[model samples]
Target: MKAQFPIFDICKLSRCEQEDIFISRLAPFLDKHQNLLLSHKHTFYHIVLFTEGAGSHDIDFQRFLVRPYQIYFMGPGQVHSWSFEGKVDGYVVNFSTQFFQSLLLKADYLDQFPFFNGNVAEAVIDLSTNLHPLILDLFEKLVHESETVQHLRQDMVRVLLVQLFIQMDRLSFERPVHQATAYNYTLLRNYQKLVEKNYTSLKLPREYAELLFITPGHLNALCHEVLGQSAGEVIRDRIMLEAKRLLTNLSLTISEVAYQLNFADNSYFTKFFKKHTGLTPEKFRDGLFNQLSQDALSLQ
Candidate 1:
């Protein structure tokens, strides 16, 4: 049978009882939440403002230490979990992609923020204490607007979210030194978007380079300079991530997983998976289930 992961959609979770936006205090939210505090993906976006709490959060397999005056931004499709000691006091705001896209118009409008960048490996933003009031004020406004139907409440919420996004972008972690040039940055972002869209069918570095109107060598250099990974590695990583996702669904046979991922054959897919992840497909899937079981046992 297919192993299923919980996908929390804001609209569904809200049950139309509220708007597409949902806000709650972090401590109580965590008290009622179990699945998402562990590894899970959301169908909508999450902006967490950690006014008080200290621990770690894992996003897409990368773990980040959490601190007060810190905020975390997670986009749709990212897998994440959090573990913190002691009381966690803060706010969590979840809004649907539809909620923002209806206002922004651009399909990839969210991509403009550095933390939301597809190529970015981390998204934690630490701000100075002085900025906490301003940040918290915006969050409070979002919560207030979500509760009552006021004139232009939707507009006010959108305005606050945009302001929060802009402020958070300013506080985002700095890009690598090599990403300074606007041209290189733009090219890199374009490549990332292309990879997300076409990683399954367009597997080769040259294919992406052709789409970007650049030589394979230039693309490779840009990838290495800005992301510290070769163009091929980035492509492989995306494929591997998808492979893992599929493997979690026990309903799919190994061969089926390979076929779904566009591999020519099962054996070749196993080789590719092992090369990048140091585990055969079967072992990888078994290991993941075993680890999940252990986590459940420990919690009990």
Candidate 2:
């Protein structure tokens, strides 16, 4: 059977102009608990700002806790899930890659910040006592402006984000050279985000180069310089992750999964899946189910 990737909930996407948009979803998991049971791999990447509540988040195979005043940046293709302790209060800021445009964080530099990576992961942050007030202040202004001065919310959100980004970038353990590449980082970021969203649909580096007005070779150079992987690698990685999601998550037959991912036939899907994970469709499915059953029995 072919594989299909999970779909995201982000309905619209604006260009990389302005700062960002804010929708204060203060309601957490209670009666309002709308858990996104992705029966498949998730597609639209987004972020989470925890205002209040305790929860555990699982990204791919990693697990972490979510605390208050913490922010996480997630990208388009990451397989993630979360469970809140009773009422989980937070803001689900589902922004497009266009908004995250590689300006602030390069794809390579962002490897540690899984929240921002397109593969989909939730990061947790619990700022020290000295920095708590700063985040609180920003959150207050964001909520206040959201209610009162609705006009200036976008700019305020930008400032708040810049604060968090700066702090997180500082706390990162990367060397000074890696941290100092903030210059024109957003341009690279925009390019990266563009590719993450459209790489599957838009083939060829030149296609992306055309959109960015740069040559394909130059774009490839930049990708390798920053991401340590070729542009094609990044694209293929996203597609492969999506394919895995479809093959493993949903119970759809291989043919359906293949068509959803735009593959021409089951043979192509099998070849692609086998290329990434040396196992054929039947073997992969059997292994996944076997693992799940073992986990279930262990819990029992």
Candidate 3:
């Protein structure tokens, strides 16, 4: 199959870019997108729910046929492409990373949400039947910003985002942790944010600890207490995930990918990758390619 055409971040639209979000119904453009199957890299954050149509998304190698009210997480740096038949309709809520960063200051508990891992996770309850109206209303408010009265625009947006996060929190599998942390909890949370934002760059624990205004030891202790993993371990997982993403999606050679990942040399990157994957880079790629070919042959 041909790789899909490139996808753009909707927030980059002229008007929407200023507001940090873009929302639109899908049916109108579904005809253009369905056959073309335009897919490529994206860096913005979003949560797309199919409110009115039955369609599908090609996420990595997983093809999820999106039914009505199905919600899929659109994380930063993940590659996603779409397709549908006539009148394919849904709502796309595009938001900036800043929006989520600030929201996490409050609903950080979503860190345990499992569906964010490039999988089509179903919500336990079909909240979209009720929640869709709220999102539509919020989108209307966002659409007609001129109507936002003096001193009320930011206030309205803050409330709207909070509501959205609340809905997401309800869907998370982790039983809610209502005990709002005291002053010290901020350290781990901030450290987590740092890891998320700069994991590709910061290889050492001290780098993150210094940024969070804490010692390496304290950072390690906090993560171990709450997550059963040290700060370094968390950083490694994020880096390794990015590495795997490139390996699976891009056509770059191992040495080229290693340089892009900031390894001092190919050998070091190979060792690091093998440590986690239990196979050399060449063997790993061959294994996945073989699996894909076998699946294709089986389908035939």
Candidate 4:
């Protein structure tokens, strides 16, 4: 498929060469990159530990209201944006998959964290006041080590990230509602990974079920049981997500977006998008531009 949602390169966005990990304060980062921050997907993992903020963050169309002492996580390719009423005080961490591979041999090291599971569950964690200091300290150390040129700085960054991940994982399990049977969780995780990799080419739920060696009905059942949605919803949501991302790029025309997504024609794409999102492509793009204009005016 053609480019979906303008995949941002970590090094280019950070303006640093050969750096896989990017960390900075949320307010300043948002200030500098406000134009690109809204309505685009990143090629790197996004972690933001918010110390003070009241906002609403959107991840793949799922909305979560943000509060202080909470952390938000978004895996690569997930679209996210934030709207806040007041200043946001926190640390933003962006790291590529390469950063993980450099430290560990396992390909699934990042998958161990529940927040990165691609499913809609536990993407945001509300931290206890007692744990705030520990989390803040870890982020501060990472920022310092990232700026300082020292022996094994990369190694040190990786260690700090692993530590942060471990802490978050521990807290994830403390919430009983986030737990799932191992078998079902594994099935969903595998399905999500396949969807992430092949959503553009393989659009059918049965295709994913076939690849997973399961019946389509069984897959749907598992999805409904685990995620409160059907297998078809999951697949369609992924497709529509890319559609929204492509729509965000004003450079691409409606027909071009449809063609890149492999839709038979513009009409079919508009029908599909409207059925899911309740808005045609043109309307959605227009609404986005209108909202952006209003935000800019507010700044003025």
- Could you tell me every candidate's TM-score relative to the true structure? 0.89, 0.55, 0.60, 0.84
lDDT of 4: 0.82
lDDT scores in order: 0.80, 0.60, 0.61, 0.82
lDDT score, residue 92, model 3?
57
Model 2, 143-257: lDDT tens digits are: 5655565665556665666665666656542433243256434445667677666855775777878888888787787777666777777677767766666666656788887
The sequence of per-residue lDDT tens digits that candidate 4 reaches over residues 165-254 is 999988876776446777877888889889878887898899999999999999998888777889888888778878877787878999
Best by TM-score: 1
Residue ranges of candidate 3 with Cα displaced over 4 Å: 1-7, 11-21, 27-29, 35-39, 52-76, 81-89, 95-185, 213-217, 248-251, 282-300
Order the candidate numbers by lDDT, best to worst. Answer: 4, 1, 3, 2
Question: How far is each candidate from the true structure, as Cα RMSD in Å?
Answer: 2.4, 8.0, 6.9, 3.6
Full ranking by TM-score: 1, 4, 3, 2
| Candidate 2 ranges beyond 4 A from true positions | 1-56, 60-70, 75-79, 83-130, 140-184, 210-217, 248-251, 281-300
Instruction: Estimate the TM-score for candidate 1.
Output: 0.89
Off by over 4 Å in 1: 1-4, 177-179
Query: How many angstroms is residue 79 displaced in model 2 relative to the true structure, after the best TM-score fit?
Result: 4.1
- For lDDT, candidate 1 versus 2, the one ahead is 1
Residue 165 alpha-carbon offset, candidate 4, angstroms: 2.0
Better of 1 and 4 by lDDT: 4
